[model samples]
Target: MTSLTLALDAMGGDHGPLVTVPAALQALKSNPSLKIILIGNQADIDPLISHADSTVLNRIERIHTTEIVTMGDRPVHALRTRKNSSMRLALEQVRDGKAAACISAGNTGALMAMSKVLLKTLPGIDRPALVSCLPTVSGKPVYLLDLGANVACDSETLFQFAVMGSVLCEAINKNPTPKVALLNVGIEEIKGNDQVQQAGQILQHTEQLNYIGFVEGDEIYTGNVDVIVCDGFVGNITLKTSEGIAKLLVHQLKRGLNSGFFVRFLSKLISPRIQAVLSKMNPDHYNGASLIGLRGIVVKSHGNADEAAYLQAINLAATEAKRRLPEMINDRLESILLDINS
Candidate 1:
């Protein structure tokens, strides 16, 4: 049996153990053999777990961490000075080989900071990218890269992103021939910047990728494309915008249904369909993003993730850990980089 031990920064998120403790418990119910090293103040975390089941308590272990790396602080400084912080401690567990992977629903900057400084990147990977999957309007999920990691990416970096994102799709999403596209201001190669234009040309020539040229923002929710590549700044904005739009749609749907007798009558007729639509749109479905290209597996969840949200994140972590995602990436990437250089 594979020992799937994961270190979680229980103190790193907005809700802290309030949500973390329950999430951990929920994950355990599904993954019984999973070993967890909760990094947080015992006093803070203990209270949350006190009334819980004995069996759940037995499987989970604790590594008390007092200091915390806040979201607003400078990321690099927080990592350095907050030596005993939960995020740092949790990351160290993976770096030291004590754990297979690390999961955090905390500061994105700090998580990326610790990843770059401690885990390091694989050879030929210029930088590690944050990659997430979002449900498209077409009902399929698309892989979006650099979702706020590397804001300024070059042509070669984009090529690397395609490779990593495709491999990820194959592993988790079962996307055999994952179509790759560059997110442009317009759907044409000529519509993008010099870097993007250059990347478009390069992707067209790359044999490894199923490159499909350029795509626009609206096309993302349509699921016409599989991999949407962009710099972190663009990807981040696009993701947040999509989230906001989804929320707005849900908000309007709720209001429209609750107004009056006619509205309520219409709502009853459309309730099932609307619920099905909203269920698919729920952020929990795509709750985890892999910090790809690092020496080890590191997944980041939303800062305000709830129990079910973290459950999705942990499911991702467990799958990757069992498959030994880090080792697999290293193996597959080594020969590719070598071939490119040769």
Candidate 2:
């Protein structure tokens, strides 16, 4: 197998090299064919490398950058001022074909802005959407798009999201004809605003989309749909809300289990099963969100992600790079456009 190189913004996340470097090393352990280009201040990154096994060290390289894009930095500001920052350098690696993909846990706004400018959008794509995998009840994951890329979208944009999202699911999840849905207030025909309803009309008419009608927010976890499309504002809110609720439930369940001696004993008896379920629901396992529609693959890790979560993001980038996801998306997009024109 050919080796895959990923460019990582070592200074992007809250913990910078402290978290990203360790994660990159851990990811390298699992994926033998993977190599990483770590972009950040050498003073900080060199020490982390010094601690890694020498064999693992051979697969890693470092690029030095003095500037850092903080979580509080404005997207526009980062674009103009931080041209040589770790984030921009990492993206440049992908754009220049030195790396197959780029991963950052920096400011979402800045990453989106920089990636769009550097990588550009695929032909026939108006704007890139933030896509991510979410675990569903059927044990199959649902791909959600426009997680926060475009805050407001038109009917046409929603249609594009569905197409891009479907292609993504097919490429990564190996679902050839992933069921697609428009997230809305209800399942009724007249449920959503003009954009959503109009988008639904287009989807229903489009060929080979497998477009299901409107789906409620509650249906997101039901595994009833393989792909859920929505404007970024709604999608972002929905993702964050779901994550919060999942954490809360886990916390409450632990409290209940520790309430008394008998309860604790029973918890131990069922701990294995409970842990399996909890592991499936853990957000860390799904930390990478793809900025799809761009010419190259760029994954956004959570700003506050730990080593484990960051490792998941790196693995995601490696998987997509190996799959050549950007090319797959472009090809599928052309087909979808041709169908629309026909």
Candidate 3:
């Protein structure tokens, strides 16, 4: 593989440079052809990488910026005012072709806004959607999109999201015909709101997509479908709620395992299997969400991600960059649009 550079918002997360710097270095170590541009306050970043060897230092670059977009910052404020912020600059790197992709663990709203402005949406893409993968019963990834990017979406926008999601799923999972579905209250035809029902109608007629019917929340992890499309409001709630449930399950299991002596002995017998299952279900393993439909690549990491989780985000960025995901989606959308217009 050729060298691919990723720009990182080093000061955008809760731990900022403390977490990002180590993850960057570790990414470089794992992928020899990877280069990183750390965008943040130089003072904080320098000390973290100061003890690194020449080989490591040679592949890293820094663009110093003291400005940061906090978690509390509004999207409009960040886009209009914080031009020099780390998140903005990191996105700028992708826009200018200085980086193959940009990754941030910053304010979600601000990051989404900045990325849209700097990267811009591709032709025929009305809006960029946020997409992330979840573990499934079949052991294949189930891609979910529009996770809090646009709170309200029209039928056409939702259809666009389904196309984008399908393309992304195919690219990442190598499934030629990824099954797509709309999240709804029920699998029946007349269950969803007009927007969802209409989008489903559009998708059904689009021969370019493998449009399946409605899927309820219970089917998200069933892996029966590869892509589940929804408006941002519903997608965000579903994602957060799933994350909470996963955490609760893990915590309860660990607590039970540590409880009485007899239980502890029983736990030892089944601990390895349970731990293996838990490891696969860990949220940190799936910490990055791609902001799709943009002209360039951008990944949003969890705000409180640690080095391990942040590294997973970096890996995601690298995969998308290598795949040239944006160009792929652009091409697919163009083909689909031409077919519709014809």
Q: How high is the CA lDDT of each candidate model?
A: 0.85, 0.93, 0.93
Residue ranges of candidate 1 with Cα displaced over 4 Å? 265-276
TM-score of each: 0.93, 0.94, 0.96
Candidate 3 regions exceeding 4 Å error are 254-259, 268-273
Sort by TM-score, best first. 3, 2, 1
Taking the tens digit of each residue's C-alpha lDDT, what string does model 3 give over 1-342? Answer: 689999999997889999999999999888889999999999999999998887789999999989989888899998998989999999999999999999999999998888888888999888899999999998888999899999999999999999999999988888999999999999999998999999988988999999989999999999899999999999999999998998898899889788999999999999999988887787778899999999999999998888999999999999999999999999999999999889
- Model 3: lDDT to the true structure: 0.93
Q: Going through the candidates in order, what is the number of backbone clashes in each?
A: 1, 0, 0
Q: Please name the candidate that would achieve the greatest TM-score relative to the true structure.
A: 3
Write the residue-wise lDDT of candidate 2 on 228-288 in tens digits.
9999999999999998998999999999898889999999999999999998788878899
Candidate 1 C-alpha lDDT tens digits along 220-248: 87888888899898999998888898899
Alpha-carbon lDDT of model 2: 0.93
